[model samples]
Target: MRWERGRRSRNLEDRRAQGAGRRTGRLRLPLPAGRGGKLSLTSLLIMVGLYFLIGPEALQGLGGLGGGGLPGGAQVGLPGGGSGDVASGPLRTTPAEDELVEFVSFVLDDAQQTWARLLPGYREAKLVLYRDTTRSACGVGQAQMGPFYCPGDEKVYVDLSFYGELRSRFGAPGDFAQAYVLAHELGHHVQHLTGTEARVRRAQRSSPGDANELSVAMELQADCLAGVWGHAAAQRGILERGDVEEGLRAAGAIGDDRIQGMAGRAVQPESFTHGSSAQRQQWLGRGLDSGDPAACDSL
Candidate 1:
């Protein structure tokens, strides 16, 4: 991607120097019981009840809730200290990491600008750059969760170290891949602004049994929205050769099925929260091919 000349976003909040507060007790959700551990209707109703009582925050760490960069939105925190290691001193970064920060800033601004033009009264969402852990309106965010958008606070949270894991562990690498992660999170911001998110939550509550399927649709739609931004960036000469491929690779890398396979678990389509690899690639490619948000109505 040709991003050095791009504009930096003013909505960025760099909290790397600050320490994360002390760890809080996590609320664990019950796993599905019975055949293949499928969530029983009773279990589903229990989660739905929790949702009504505590809002989405109650489902913060739950995989398939569309809160993280990866399919399950995994949350991993460092042990000891409220702020983790950075609490002891200022954060350090290599030149490459510094450049990565600038790159994300550019992507944030560029993607928001695209939305501002595409959607009326579109407000910019802030991006919080933190380390190890940070407090979000939804709950505590951890590095292992990858990048996520919290609708409660209308901000995107990201830990840059995840990029290294994305490259090495996930087998997805390239600057555009990193940008895709941010774009997808911002797509959640768009959902929040347009009432799509609220409506989905209502639907999830009303039909608890369909919650996972609803989440998959929501996530696929976000992938399409990200591709919509990619389309705009390409039109403005911001994309280069292989950039699209990088984004697709990133999308495929985090598919629930692929992640499950990586974990050495059986591929369970019924349990998928973020859809399969083919589904994600298909939706993302649809937006890229059409370059129209209308073409991205996966929901």
Candidate 2:
């Protein structure tokens, strides 16, 4: 992709220096689905009731309601004093990663620019670049979770190393593929801005049994919104010949079914929170084909 033609954003925050001794925190339990990664009131009440019923000992055995600083029991953390001296100086990276950083800034700026024009009352969300682990309003963010947008703090968190996995493991190598990850997270920010996030969370609470399904819809919508950004980017002629295909490969590569298979787990639709490979490709295609944000209504 022609990322150089895009603008750079001043809202980028570099926190890579403070990533040495970050504790790798993981969620050993489940969490309330939807609304990014916050604990819902209903989940809290259930936890309180459980605490009263079983005491702390048994609760801890059950992973303390996924309290290992993960979202629904995923790894989450940021480097603090425990992680050696957190870098306070400017981050210097290898020539390759430096280019990646610039690409990220450009993509973020482009996405925000598009949203500003497409949506009313849109505010550009900030991006935070960190490594190893980082604290986010959503949960403890580790590279394992890839790029995530924290609705709680209105910021996007990224560990650049995840790009290595995206390229090597997912087999979706390209600048556009990397940009798609950022766009997807930014799409989450769009969801937050439009109040779709809150509405989804409320819906989840109303039907706990369907929480995972709702979460999948939310994720698919974000994917479609990401495609919307791609549409806008393409309109400006930044997209190259294989860019769309690269993005589609990326969408399929990270589908819940693919990820589960990669992890050696049996494919189970009931447990899917991010849809299947085909579903992701379809929604992403919908947004890219129409160039309309409304076309991304996966919910």
Candidate 3:
């Protein structure tokens, strides 16, 4: 993505070291005593299903697995594990982590610069870089949840570990794919600033049955907004050949349908919180092609 050509963000805060507190303890889920006390797969699935009902944050913490990810934001506490209070310190980074830091800083700063001129009185949101798990105003922020923006704190949270999963599991390897994820979270910050997020929450309350559908629309709009940032980057020559393809690939790869299929589950449209793969790719292309924020009116 040629991120080195971009400016570094002054709003970047390192919380990686702070998030490295000791694990709370091992989870002891109840299992029916069997021959030799072996736990059955049915018992495992049942326990996991119980946690899932609690919330995404609780499910991930309880199972010690990270599967589903919302497009932009998260709410609720991390069910168990990790220290609640994270001590502040400078981030201790290795050579690879250092590269990631640089890339994130550049992408964030450039996105801020683009929004500033596009939206009058635009304020940059701080991007918090943490590891393992940490506290956020919205709820618990964990590496497994991927990148998310907390409107309550006006900050974007990310863990470097997510970049590995983006390449390995999502099959969207590239600096552009990583940037696309960050840009999408920042897009949520934009929605909050524009009062769109508040209005949507209110509407969701009034029409609870449409909650998932509204969420899908919100996520699709974020994807479009991310494409706007990509457009600006391209005009600045920061984007190289195939960068758009990488971003598009990421958009499709993380769609609700695709993620559900990846888990070997039924792709239920009514249960979709994020749009389908085609919808995501189409919206992203709309923003990139038009290079206008108005083109992202998914509502």
Candidate 4:
């Protein structure tokens, strides 16, 4: 992807230097690697709920959420502090961090700009970059929770190191794959603007038993929306050979089914919130093929 010279987004909130010892300081979740070396499904579900329903404040209350300072101890809202610090950090990047940030900003700008132009009554959303732990309108967002969009705040929070996991453990390595992740989060923003997220939350509350399925549908729609952006990006002559393949790999890598399978359990369809790998690929493919946002409304 030819993203280096693209427009950088002004919506990026750099909270990397806020320092540690926060007000209600909560623990960070473990990364996809390390001692336990596995993503916790239960914790992630809790995070998803906090991110979308309760808010970040709820994260601090989770009993098992633990970890010392992030390698850099950069607090959220402090631009480029903890997660962006280069010296002695837990998830330090090897010179590519700036490049990754630039790439992320560019894609964000593209997606939001697209929405602003195409969607009626669209409001721009901010992207927050932080390290191990940070405070958000939703509650305390832990880096271990992976990237999530907090609808309450209308902001997307990401721990940059997750990109490394995207390349390594997730088996989806490429610039476009990273873009897909950002686009997926932005898709949540789109949902917020369109009231889809609110409807999903209402449905989840009204029917507790179907919450996971509803969540999966919402996530799958986001994947499709990401694909729609991919299609637009391709038409702009930025997509290279195999870029689509990289994106598909990413959509599959983070699927709830794949994550659960990696955790050594039988794939329980009812427990899935992000859809299966095949479903992700299918919806993403639909978006990529059509490039129309309306075509992405699979739910």
Please report the candidate that would top TM-score against the real structure.
1
lDDT of 1 by residue, 1-299 (tens): 99874345699998876553422213346676658867889989987775564454543533221323343333432222243333435555556767778999999998999999999999999999887667777776666567788888899998776777678778899999999888988888998999988888889899989988888888898899999999999999989999999989988888888888877778889888788888999998887877788887867
Across 63-94, the per-residue lDDT of candidate 3 in tens digits comes to 11112653222322232223444344444455
- Worst 10-residue lDDT window for candidate 3 reads 58-67
lDDT per residue as tens, model 2, 50-73: 455434332111100001112222
Tell me the spans in candidate 1 whose CA falls farther than 4 Å from its real position: 5-8, 20-86
Q: What are the models' TM-scores?
A: 0.80, 0.78, 0.79, 0.77
Provide the overall lDDT of each model, using Cα atoms, as 2-decimal numbers. Answer: 0.77, 0.73, 0.74, 0.72
lDDT of model 3 at residue 12?
A: 88
Ranking the candidates on TM-score from highest down gives 1, 3, 2, 4
Number of the top-ranking candidate, with lDDT as the measure: 1
Instruction: State the weakest 10-residue window (summed lDDT) of model 4.
Output: 61-70
Clashing pairs in 1: 20-82, 20-83
TM-score, cand. 4 vs. native: 0.77
Better of 1 and 4 by TM-score: 1
**Measured by TM-score, how close is model 2 to the native structure?**
0.78
Instruction: Report RMSD (Å) for each prediction in the order shown.
Output: 8.4, 9.5, 7.9, 9.3
